[model samples]
Target: MILPCTSAAQDGWLRLRQALWPDCPEAEHLAEMAGFLREPDKYAQFVAYDEDGQAAGFAEAALRTDYVNGTETSPVAFLEGIYVAPQQRRQGWGRALVDAVTAWARTRGCRELASDALLDNVASHLMHRALGFEETERVVFFRKELS
Candidate 1:
């Protein structure tokens, strides 16, 4: 797998998104992917390719200057999402995806890296732990229906 992204990979990136959100309608999925592609730096996303140049995974990295949950520093690179194909799991492909995005973060002078998954996502929790992220704090959203 390679460590950088290019314009040529946009189509492959969209494919990866579709794989990750299989339930999303094609029109919505394509629109979401296109929004990222419209960015000036494409700093919001990156693609992981397999040996045959197929998109095996995707890592969406973005820099946020304000309110990163675990750190006080500004301009932290937040990993918005990462997904490796089911067949590609457990083969170090996911870690490679993270590594690729981390390297990209360092270039942008990011002082810290941050990512979050749903509280009950066991696999995500394990992956984050394996990657050396600590349990900083747990946040639970509360909701009440308005009648």
Candidate 2:
């Protein structure tokens, strides 16, 4: 089953988020989750549960008015992150989460959905393709610091 994340206290969502982004502190995760909840129209999140009612995965998406590479539409639904428990992968949990996010985006009048993965994460690339996303572009961001 797929469930929308209606509360920041939703442990399943937080747990999956931490699993996907292990480097982020719990406090930071909570803070960001709260922020997303406060903006329901701009952000959407979903959690997937197995038949046994255990959390299996989670996905977060945002409506971005700013330009998203490879997308031609404004206010595109951009998938921020998605994670399925290692033991739960290949079981359609990730697809369920993305489907939920896509439905939410449609309600918000978005015409397209966009997502990105690290260049080195080949698994993610394959998963995106399996989920019906086509490659748009490859970019390497550059930055410089000046005092």
Candidate 3:
């Protein structure tokens, strides 16, 4: 089962995020995740539970008013993070989590959903493809510190 991540769910979410992140094959930003969960408008993270009532996976999504990957205007839905346990993969848990998020987005009239993975994350890329995601564009980000 999948459910919204609330204050009560924070600890588990954080733990799962840190655990799966090694294989996440994407960006790592814990402070940002904390802020997003604490701040109302920043994000909506969710967690999935297994038959034993143990947390199995998580997904972090948000309403990005800024430009999304493929849209003209703000993104109706943006997937910041998603992770399923290696043992739990190939089951319907991840897809159920995605469905939950999309359902949440559609309620607000969201048209599209966007997510990104590192260039070399074959598993993630395959998952996206299985979910019917198409590659729109790929741009590498560069950051500089000027103080």
- lDDT tens per residue, model 1, 24-93: 9988866766666676353567777788877778888888877977787888888888998888888887
lDDT of 2 by residue, 64-112 (tens): 9999999999989999999999999998888888899989999999999
User: After superposing candidate 1, which stretches have Cα over 4 Å from the reference?
Assistant: 3-5, 8-11, 40-42, 143-147
> Per-residue lDDT for 58-123 in model 3, tens only?
888888888887775555688878888778889977788888888877775678888888999998
Q: Count the backbone clashes (under 3 Å) in each candidate.
A: 0, 0, 0
The 10-residue segment with the lowest total lDDT in model 2: 8-17
Highest lDDT: give the candidate number. 2
Q: Which segments of candidate 2 are over 4 A away from where they belong?
A: none
Candidate order, lDDT descending: 2, 3, 1
Q: What TM-score does structure 1 among the candidates reach?
A: 0.83
Could you estimate the TM-score for every candidate? 0.83, 0.97, 0.82
